[model samples]
Target: MAVVSACIVALSGCALPRSGPKDDEILAGSKAEGGPVNVVLVDNRVAVASYLDDNLSFPSSFTGAGLASTDTINPGDVISVTVWENVDPALLVGPGQKQAFIQEIQVDQAGNIFMPYAGVLKAAGNTPEQLRRLITRKLDPQTPDPQVEVRRVAGDGSSISVIGGVGAQGVYPLVPSTTRLSAMLATAGGVTIDPDVAQVAVRRGGTTGRIFLQDLYDDPRLDVALRANDKIIVEEDRRTFTALGATSTQARVPFPQGRMSVVEAVAEVGGLNGNTSDPTGIFVFRREVQSIANKVTGRNDLGENEPFVYVIDLTRPDGVFLAKEFQVRDKDTIYITEAPFVAWTKILTATSQTLSFTADVVRVGDLLTDN
Candidate 1:
């Protein structure tokens, strides 16, 4: 018996939850001191939808940052180059000398470009500017000093894909080393109100990481280095917000950010339905994993093991305040009860729920009340 117990402990690492509430609580809880939790937080996510999605080229100024991009040019890649020799305008100067003939440059199997005098030179792995300099160096020997310009007429470096919740989709500018994914989101015109920042996926080769676009506004942790031939996908979270109980105005909003909290969510909807608001009866329906089976499958529904619901009373000053700061994830239904009097409204919800795209409905409820 003793040996069997010891073996069980050792094997716990590989064990999967069986089923029920106990399993969900153990596997799907948040790591933060007060994290917004649920089966969805573990599965679905979209950080901030209200903010602008930056879609710009690698900033001309991001040259010094140690951004590492694993992007490389392979064969069959097409490119365009505009070459010049001293003051001679014939090689590149168009028929009217109005513009130039170089629209797109193509690379050959030999890995070279046939410029007027520079002949063929290596371009794979080198940036446009890097390629330009290589061409200039070759021409300088024959011409006093030469100027060379290179553009990706049709190639991997010039194309970028924007997905998820933005107004526009498809490829945009192929920014340089300094450009980040957030910059491109803005270029595509930012995310819609039902934005999916968390599930925004970026894949290079087999490597992938979830990007939190909201973090782009301040936190540097979520920053992802851009690369050519990389795909940035905005994935959607399938869920909804169900508002029920004492609040005057209640409805289901979009569900993609996981479970939202009582107070933060209430304020987001415009604060308790003023006319007849209850201070108690605030409840948020959340998903709590009960067993390993529920967690392993990434399920948000409560299992027989765990019933995920918290009756948070906003009547008490302390509880009321916690509601303002806590987040509400997707699949969370925030129920605000009516307060005894407008008297409680005197206190300001200075630290309230983060603004969202859906309509805000404040519910007044007693933290101790049962739904």
Candidate 2:
């Protein structure tokens, strides 16, 4: 019995240590020596939901101006020009020619269109109405009181390209003054991934901007007007957070909707291990921007720019509400410290299994000796 007790002590000593600082220890250290990370203790009295409401906001992509209806002609756009002369005898048309003479012309690479009497007229940058007035003026001397009309038959050059994570990638023509971001996406058969978590990127000229698809739907202002030559791309939101320590499972979890709350993140990783996790030591480690960190910690004397550890004590009922309000950002680390008794429990379980196996071996030896 003495030898067995010694063996039990030795085996129990081999158990893993309960690592990480305790809640009270961390708080005590913070009061004594200031650390790099600003540890914010969350409890029932803290207004976490209100803080999130004040700080977190969806980006607005709406420009001040409304959609412009006047679409300028561009190279490769097919246009039709029609001319009606009132005079009985005309140079281009025969005498008593009441029928209008139509000319189908495509804007050349030089941004000019050819007409019978107008010669080479610039059409790429000018609107259809503006081009009509110019052509009518040019034909004034040749044809008496000439009525000229310019219309775009096909707008191939004025099209937006939709690609990446879409059902069908193709070029969609923009209707004059009508096409918006949502319209272009609809033309491409919508995004392949869930729109709530997907990122919609629009590249125009030399600048590019990206916003969550959910933001676009929530705020119509984010669905800005689409322009010709704009490239729209939809992609899955790859934001993720890692669960470690005493959680039911330890793994990296993706935020499919681009946003996740602390409670949801915990649930995603199979929740905290009931037998091993320390309810008072649940923490979310996040490296926030300096401004945000300063606001959250309310401390300017932080030693380093290390990540802040927001501690949540699940032992209290208010902790559930706080966790629900606490939003989890991308690349965050959620750790649940082990309970103090967990190591001893593990040691006892291991010892019991070992002793049971030894008893079975002794019983088999006794049976063999009797035989």
Question: Best by lDDT, which number?
Answer: 2
What is the C-alpha local distance difference test score of each model?
0.52, 0.75
Q: Candidate 1 on 1-371: residue-level lDDT in tens?
A: 55444434444443332212232242345333244443222111211211123222223223223554333443435666665544545444544353344655667665666676678788777766788788878877776565567765545444567776777887765545336767777777777645432446666667655544544555554555566556777656545677764554577765434344455466556667756555555555555335532543445553653434444445565656556544565566676544433322322121122121111422324333545
- Model 2, which residues run further than 4 Å from truth? 15-38, 44-61, 85-104, 108-110, 303-305, 354-371
Return the TM-score for each candidate structure: 0.48, 0.80
Which window of 10 residues has the lowest lDDT sum in candidate 1?
Answer: 42-51
**Per-residue alpha-carbon lDDT of model 2 for 38-148, expressed as tens digits?**
577775444352144322222343344367453688887778877877887775677777556565688887888888778999999998999999999999988778888
Q: Give residue 24's error in model 2 in angstroms.
A: 8.8
Q: What value of lDDT does candidate 2 attain over all alpha carbons?
A: 0.75
Error of 2 at 67 (Å): 0.9
Give the per-residue Cα lDDT of candidate 2 at 44.
44
Candidate 2 collision pairs: none
